[model samples]
Target: MIEFVFHTDDVARVRFAFSPLWELVRGLRVLADPSRHALHLPWVHAVRPKLRGLDVGFLRSAVPATDYIPDFLTPPPGTPLPDFAAELEIVRATPPEVVAEELRLTERGGAAGAARRAMAAEPARTLEAVCVQLGRFWSAAVEPYWERIRDLLEGDVLRRTRALAANGAEGVFADLHPAVRWHGGTLFVDRRWDYRGELAGRGLLLVPSVFVWPQVSVMVPPYQPMLSYPPYGVATLWESSPAAPPDALAALIGRRRAELLLALGSPASTTELSRRLNVTPGAISQHLGVLRACGLVTGHRLGRRVLYTRTRAGDALAESPSVQ
Candidate 1:
């Protein structure tokens, strides 16, 4: 079990952020063993062919089958939403000593160990190679679907932040995951090892990831205290196409608008809607304007993005038996 003791100030400091780098690192695990990460099989099938010519041997070795992933590869995001380039720079700048220490810890007796040893021997050189490979991997595999993935992650943060505001930390922790628990002033994470750390008023960073499903990862001292868990609705992330809206609703709102409403079952941004529906952002904005005017949808500003969701009336219409 891992426990993080929080003070009153720490509670107020708890914040949420999105990490593209985290997704890329965790994605490597999913790609390494598609069978264990069945939810991402659709992604694996699509990405494997793209990665055929890329040499990810060092990258693959860094993420062993065990839970220990080299910390240098995934530094917690410093901002709420950092692009891949910003995060990659952080990785590129990791101190050589830190790299050697982490690699040493990752070392074990096997093929993976040999890779780790080689990396430890020349930290700076190996780190650059890892970064280069990561850049290529991201372009081919993650960047293509980032819009959809970011939408899901953003929606999750919005939901959880609201929960935190309405019901405090307890509310957010209630359904976070089976392995996580909160009691009094301490947060507990069930893990193979035991550890205790204090927030020390730095609070904690809550990161929602698309690929860390069915498992939650925690970071401790020498790094920002953070937790990465699968965001809600990740299971449906790779669906080839959206479900068709009810025929009656489609006829009433026009098929395009109805499809937009159905997609808003969870909050989403204009960019997300555009990408998911294969519609232009301009078209999506026009339709959203109509939906808003009709009292069928509402938008809320979360950071730089405004997320749209169905209003109560819109929910009724979407769920009405007559519409089905």
Candidate 2:
């Protein structure tokens, strides 16, 4: 068990963030063991053939079977939400010393060792090469689905923030994952190794992940502490079709609008809705505008993007049995 002892100030400092770089790193796990992550199988199958030409050896070596991927390769996100290109640049510029030290931690034998040696001998050149491959890989595999994935992550953060306000840190941690527990001022994680650390004041960053489900993971200290857990509403990613609404509700709002209302059972962005409904963003914007004007859906700006959710009346209308 890994115990994170939080100080009074630490509690106040806890925040949520999303890392494009971290997601790239985690995607390696999905690529390495596609069958193990059945939830991501659809994504894995789609990206597998494209990955055949990419040089992913260094990334694979960094994340050995022990789950001890180096921190330098995947830095904590610079912002609450980071752009993929910006984060990729950060990876490209990782200090040579940091890169060498991290790579040195991997097993010093065979192909893994050879890769590490090449990186250690010329960190700058090797890192640029790796980043080039990552750019290509991200373009092919992750960029297409990032908007939907990002919205789900943001929604999870919003829910957790509300939980924190209503019930405090314990409440927020309680349901984060079954592998995680909060008691007596200590956050305990059921990890393979026994460990303990005091978050003197740096607090923690909670990161929501779609791919890293079933296991809760932490980046040990010396870096800002971060806990990555599966996000809420992950199942929606693989939901190819939205659930049907009552025929009367569909008729009342027009089938497309009703479908959008039912889909807004959770908060989502315009792009997210467009992808889910297989409609154009302009079409979704028009429908959402109408829904907003009718007081059926509400939109709120979160960072640079605005998210929409159903109002109480909207929920009632969508769920009204009389409509059937």
Candidate 3:
């Protein structure tokens, strides 16, 4: 069990941010044991062939099926919305000593041990090499789908922020995960090892990750007190095809529009919707404009993008069995 005691100020300071680096690192874990992370099998199947000849051996070893991943590889995001380039630079600048120490703490046996030792012996060189591989891996596996992933993450943050406003931290943590518990003035995370610490006013950083589903990760002091949990709706992240709408409704609204309405079951951006439905962005925009004008959809500006979702009337129309 890991306990983080929080003070009044600590509660106020609690903030949420998502990181590309964290996703990339945790993603390696998924690749290492795809069976354990069945939710990500689609991603695994798509990414494996792209990774051919990419030198991610050390990265794979560092993030074994079940073991301690080096902290230096994944520092807490400096900002709420950090790009991959910035995060990669942070990894590139990690002190050689910190890299070596963290790598030494990972599993030490067989190929894993050998990889760790080699990296530990040449931390600076290893850092550069790792950064290069990470860039290639990100382009191949994550960048292609980042828009969809970011939309889900942003929606999650919006939901949690609303929960925080309405019900305080308890509301956000109450249903965060089965292994997480929040009570009194402390946050508890169930883990194989035992640990306890106080926030001491440093506050807590909440990060929602798409790859860390079915499990939660924590970073205690000596680092920012950060928790990365799977965001809501991750189960649907890799779904390539949207469900077909009822034929009757499709006839009422053009088939494409009906499909678009049904796809708005969750908030999504134009780009994300376009990719998911294989429709051009211009067509999506035109359809969304019509939906917005008709009161069937609403759009909210989040960061640089606008996320659209079904309004109450829209939901009713989509769920109406008698639309015929």
Query: Where does candidate 2 stray beyond 4 Å?
Result: 106-114, 246-255, 290-296, 311-324
lDDT of 3: 0.86
Better of 1 and 3 by lDDT: 1
RMSD of each: 2.7, 3.2, 3.0
For model 2, residues 1-324, the per-residue Cα lDDT tens digits are 889998777778889888776777788887888766788888887887877777776567656534457677677875666788888888777888888777766433323466566666877777777788778878877887788888888878877887788788987998888899999889999986677999987789899888777577788778888889998778777677798877898889899999999898777999889888999999999999999999999987788898888888998898788875
TM-score of each: 0.89, 0.86, 0.88
lDDT value for candidate 1?
0.87
- Pick the winner on TM-score between candidates 1 and 2: 1
Write one digit per residue (lDDT tens) for candidate 3, span 169-275. Answer: 79889999999999998899998777798888788999999988879998888789999999977887998878888898898888899999988877789998998
- Please give the distance, in angstroms, between residue 235's alpha carbon in candidate 2 and its true position after superposition: 1.6
Indicate which candidate wins on TM-score.
1
| Evaluation by lDDT, superior candidate among 1 and 2 | 1
Clashing residue pairs in candidate 1 (N, C-alpha, C atoms within 3 angstroms): none
**All models: lDDT?**
0.87, 0.80, 0.86
Q: Give Cα distance to truth, residue 151, candidate 2, Å.
A: 1.6
